[model samples]
Target: MRIVIFSDIHGNAVALEAVLAHIRHETAPDLIIVAGDLVADGPRPAESLAILRALPNTRFVIGNTDYDVVHERDIEYDFTRAQLSAEDLQWLDDLPFAQTVAAAPGRELLVVHANPCDLRAAIKPDHSPAIIRPLLDGVSQEIVAFGHYHVPFVRTVDRYTLVDVASVGFPRDGLLRAVYVTLTFDGANWQIAHHRIAFDAEAVARDYAAVGYPNAERKARKLLEARYRHP
Candidate 1:
């Protein structure tokens, strides 16, 4: 079985399109998981949601930003809400926090926006085993996949193989490319592959300006630099 997972698509349809195209051209995945943070930042929130919803064999888990958008808690929630329809907001509200699926006959895979404990809680790549283990208290799955920090990484903590699929829109790892993860399970074990695809950062910048996106300057700078910047 093969699975592709991506997250942190905080709008930016251009980046999402590039990542989706890469997934289509490169692999025939049995399942596709959109881990969360669908649309809360950047531009084209509705378009980004539509693209993911139209894909086949896809599962969704709500991210912290998704939750914030639904609850009107995000700083830019009003801007994002203005771009989406009532139905779109409802769809975001209905997304589950986590998904556990059978990767193979006897193997299970856990997918979440962040850690299983909380959508806002992050499990960073630099964290040690002791720091990571407690965050996964009740998780029994062999593989735990998530994306929240916008930084991609794969780490093993105790019995769990933790995979951060990374960000498609707002990547903060200093790599100016859309990122996603592919998992291939051969009954016995799961092999992980990370794919980064280049996209037009200038187009994204134009999108923010074109749409009058909130904090357009900061967002464009972050996207171009591929790292977080203070406003």
Candidate 2:
């Protein structure tokens, strides 16, 4: 079975739409797995959720913002403080934390917004074992497909392979264009494929300005200008 894994789509319809368009044109997969962070931080939270609801054979998981909105019941979030409209706030409050155990016949994959270890926290690929070991428990198998940290790469531990599928909203600058992953599991063999799509970053910036998504333009600029936080 061919399963597509993606996440960290923080309401940037421009980016997300581009990714989806590419997916439709380039590949036809059996299922799509959304890691999480379904809304907030961008202009079109409600629109994003609506599109997600429309996807066929797709699984949507919860991100930190999804959990926060569900628990806090606030009209606006800190990331989009004074930016997101009231309707957008409502959209944020409505997403679910998704998981697919016993996934795709024989292969089991954990789908989480950020990390199985800490949903509310931001974790990187090269993290210490001590920090990430606890996050792997309770799940049937590791082979996790996740997002939340915008950068993409694979981290393989002794017992698991954590795949950070990256973010369409926040692409890693100076790298291959932002993308998700295609994992095919035929009984026991697992094959991975990375997919990339092109979007208008300038158009996205313009939308950010028009929607009043807090300091979206500035934050988005920061994400695009910098290579990585540590660098």
Candidate 3:
């Protein structure tokens, strides 16, 4: 089975489009998993959600930003909610925290926005096993995949192979390219591949001003820099 998973598309439809194009050109997987944060920080919130909704055979897991938008918990929530309709919000709210897929008869793959314990808890690449083990407390899957940190990484901890599929939009890994992961499972083992697609960073950055997105300057600057910045 071949599966593609991507997350942290913080409202940049342009970047998502580029990633989707890459997914179609290469790694035509059997299933696509959208590990969340669909919209809430950049421009084109509604459009981003619509694009992902149109995908076939895809599973979704809600992320911290999605949770905030649904519950109206953060400053960005109001702005994101203003751009979305009732149905869009309902779809975000209805997303599960985690999804499990059967890779083989006894092998399984787990997908989540972040760690299983908390959507806000990021599983960074540098974290030790002790820091990651508790996050996988009740997880029984041999392979676990997630996205939240926006940095791609694959780590093995005790019995679990943790895969951070990275961000499709708003990547903070010192690169402007949109990234995701593809998993190919043979009868017994899983092979992982990370794909990074270059999109028009300038166009996406300019979209903030074009759409009059809130905190446009800071967000645009962050996108160009490909790193997080304090607002």
Q: Report the error of model 2 at residue 162, Å.
A: 0.9
- Return the TM-score for each candidate structure: 0.96, 0.83, 0.96
lDDT of 2 by residue, 77-109 (tens): 654434445655555565556577564554688
Q: After aligning candidate 2 to the native by TM-score, how far in Å is the CA of 230 from where it should be?
A: 9.0
lDDT of 1 by residue, 1-231 (tens): 899999998897999999888888988899999999999887889999999899999999999889889786545788999888999999999999898888656589999998988887788878778888888998878899999888889988888899999999988888888999999988787899999989898999878878888788877777888878422
Better of 2 and 3 by TM-score: 3
What lDDT would candidate 3 get against the real structure? 0.89
Clashes in predicted model 1: 0
> RMSD of each candidate?
1.7, 3.4, 1.5
State each model's CA lDDT, in order. Answer: 0.88, 0.71, 0.89
How much is the lDDT of residue 88 in candidate 1? 94
Maximum-lDDT candidate: 3
For TM-score, the strongest prediction is: 3
